[model samples]
Target: MIPIQLTFHGAAGTVTGSCYRLDIGDRHVLVDCGMFQGDKTIKQLNYQPWPFDPRRIAAVLVTHAHIDHSGLLPKLVKAGYAGPIYATPGTSDLLQFMLPDSGSIQEMEVERLNRRNQRRGGGIVQPIYTEQDAQDCLRLLAARDFGSWFDVTGGLRARFWNAGHILGAASIELEVETGGARPLRLLFSGDIGPEHKALQQEAMAPSDLDIVVMESTYGGRPRPKLDDSQRRAVLAEEVTAALAAGGNLVIPAFAVERTQELLADLTRLIADGTIKRVPIFVDSPLATRITSVFAKYLHQENGIKAGAARPFDGGNLRFTRTVQESMQIEQVTGGAIIIAASGMCEAGRIRHHLKNNLWRSNATILLIGYQAPGTLGALLEKGERVVRIQGDEVAVRAHIRKLEIYSGHADHDELLDWLTNRLPIHGSLMLTHGEPDAIGALHASIALWRERAPQVIVPKLDETYSLAKAQPRLMKMTQQSRRLDRYAETEAISGHDWHNDYARLMLQVQHQLRTAKSDLDRRRLLKKMQRILGRGAGTD
Candidate 1:
């Protein structure tokens, strides 16, 4: 059998851009041409040359529709890739709105930047891909169902298994055949969701994988043991606390699954009377459109398949799709909840909400997902006394509460456990899509359990690996690979320090409430909390 090779085009040293090239002799399959995110240096990588000629790419396989995972398709198409883009029905549906919306956002952002640049006599910039460029790529998309293996170029066959990260995420299983070598079975874990995730099935752990290319986003620290019940209680308690403060709770969420899951959790809490019902406003137009696609496939066998709705229902829940409706939210004094997007607080309506409420002592900033470094949200989570937003320095007096347990990525323990079940003793695992620290933690965790476990590698951009006897044989990669040590203790995603502590407290309280054994125990725990707050035991 001939030797097959895989190259890391992106998402190697740092998180965000996720691109990989699998070359089987003369044919090439590209997976996930995602955009770069986080700090400026990384974000600029989006404009870099196509590592390999796009025209030579045979096909593209998209695991989901998140901008970081699928944003650069238009750029690829713009680079002259006229290949079939494969994804699930839900992803296809989501991209119908997401891709175009991304284009619009890019254009709008560039326009704003250019106006400022023109005033300063600085060079104007153009968008990476135009709205029309995004539109053109849509015609190339063909939706395929999960569990169905289809023929890709170069005699490769691939099947999608539910990843459970986002609405339509999947772990790709590919069968690679080299004419001279034996067939190699490979699984690509596309941003795995946590085990206790809501509204989604457990991430599929398919067996017999010769090589596993998986994400290690949370590999650095295993999030503290948190159960779904405790997570539910914490959500309820946070809403109650926010309402009790007589101010609106501003939740910065992703427009995709994170927003949908939070809404579903809040709805359940209201139904159970775990928390009082309040006016909930979805303040982003992008989120509103994406939520509609989620609803469209909510009951389909290939879609969300979670037998419920009301995530987008009720008079209590309002969707603000225009600037007027979003502006009107400011008039709300208290007893309301606002969920907004641009999860990182880099842009979108969440900034407006934060600007409107950050100085209010009674208001609460409820963070419900991971915040990459250098983002406005990360600055807030880091306990910065003042943060600049829209050119105005805003005080951070509002109660900033973060719940890390709401993270969609699997933690260190869960990721290792998942690998343990699917990997062989000598199998090679390439860890991608995470900060160096996270990769190091998981890398060590693997050695801790099985001393001779699979070879764990933290690959560098442009690195290449070949398979021989089902084991990875490292090929000569670019000099960048040599600079990134697999065992280095470099820091990646140190996280919002204050935010992690606050989130830990939330999880701790939730655990205590859930494990309270009896009513007396619960009251005693509440009394202790009251004492900590300097409130009388008898007071509410």
Candidate 2:
């Protein structure tokens, strides 16, 4: 019998990228081709050479359309992977705009960086992929319906079940031929959603699997269980307080489900007179398009009821689609609400909004989703008084508030329950898509299971395992096959790299210069730093 192998290319130790490779003999398939979105070292993986040959991948099974989960498709296609990307209809529709938007962001960021590098006489860099590449990759998407088994390749059949995370999110079930009496059953829980999520049902899947791969995003953090009314009440309190602060409220939100959920809640809150309706500007063209997609799927059973009021419409909602229109929001000093992508403050118009409002003591910055470590959102959430944004030093005087009630992913208890429902796994259980602490916590929790628990394995990036009827065996790789060096892999997954340290050091230098007693003191400090750099430059 040919040996089957599984490799984790991303989202093993960190929480951003989420790709997994499954090789059944000579033919191989990819689960998710995601983009890394944390520290610079981690994000650099996007520009590196593909560890495996992209042309050899027969098919790709996408669980959702989040950028981290689907953002690298353009790059993959550009690398010569011409295979059908199977996804739910909703996910396919969402990616139609999302991927191109990601490409645009890449081009814009690279252009700005290249200009700076040009002035400094540094080497030029190209974008990982362009907008045109994203548009071209869309032709490979093949929409598959939920709850039906379909042929994926020669010996693999798959089905999609509602994961309740977002509009088109799903938990994938795969049946792989093992050349034995029975095939291997595996379930991949792709970002399982919380119970009573804004517009989704609870996550569901078939039980008694052979293997299970699950996300542990909120593993150790259990949120308060709140009903829809209570949840909206909490949101009402935050909105009222922010507006009463006498300045605009800036929200860095994910463009997909998070934006739609907030709009729906805001609409209901305004209609009930819970909060005053101010000029609400969604300063993201991608978000505006995604909102329209949400509207199209509203009448489905998995979505809103038949006659519910339009959540993403009505009120003083304005979608700023042009550059000038997004820039116009800077003039609004108070009593307005501005929501922009991306949720983590890594890219998009949100950075502009934060740059404009963070220094305003009266303004409020509300973070309503998970802020991956090393992201600007995490820095703000951690109460950093000063931050560097797009090459400018900005004082963070705005009230930074985080509301986990609106999170789409399942929390500790919810994830545990989701796992419990999929019990009787006949093989190994792999936990991934989380930080080190979260993964440990979830593993500890699972160890307390009273029944016969499956053997657990926490794989690392680029690590491969040989799958068998018994426990899977870890495979050793030679230097040539490794995608990242040992030290680089550690640094990439550590959530903080030298880039973060350099930014902090620069901020410290700036603060010291600003607070220096006199001009002479500032000059002395600069000269001392220069002398230290001169002494160490050649030695290192």
What TM-score, computed on C-alpha atoms, does each candidate reach? Answer: 0.86, 0.98
Off by over 4 Å in 2: 304-307, 538-540
Q: In candidate 1, which residue pairs clash?
A: 1-179, 1-180, 1-181, 2-180, 2-181, 220-438
| lDDT tens readout by residue for model 2, 252-362 | 999998888888888888888889978899999999999989889987865543124677778499999999999999999999999999899999999999999999999
Residue 490 of candidate 1: its Cα lDDT? 31
> What is the overall TM-score of model 1 with all chains considered together?
0.86
**Tens digits of per-residue lDDT for model 1, 1-540:** 665788887778667889989988888998888987765546666776676889999999998898988999999999999999999888898898888888988998899889988999999898999889999999999888899999897679899998878888988998877664556788889988887776666788588678899898888776777666778888888888999999889999999988888887787778777988788999988888888887877766646644245655765889988899999999986889999988888878898899999999999999887888657887788897667676566778899999987788888888887887785634688999887778888888888766658777777777888776767777975554443233321322332334335544665677688888998999999888878777555545
Scored by CA lDDT, what does every candidate get?
0.81, 0.91
Clashes of each: 6, 0
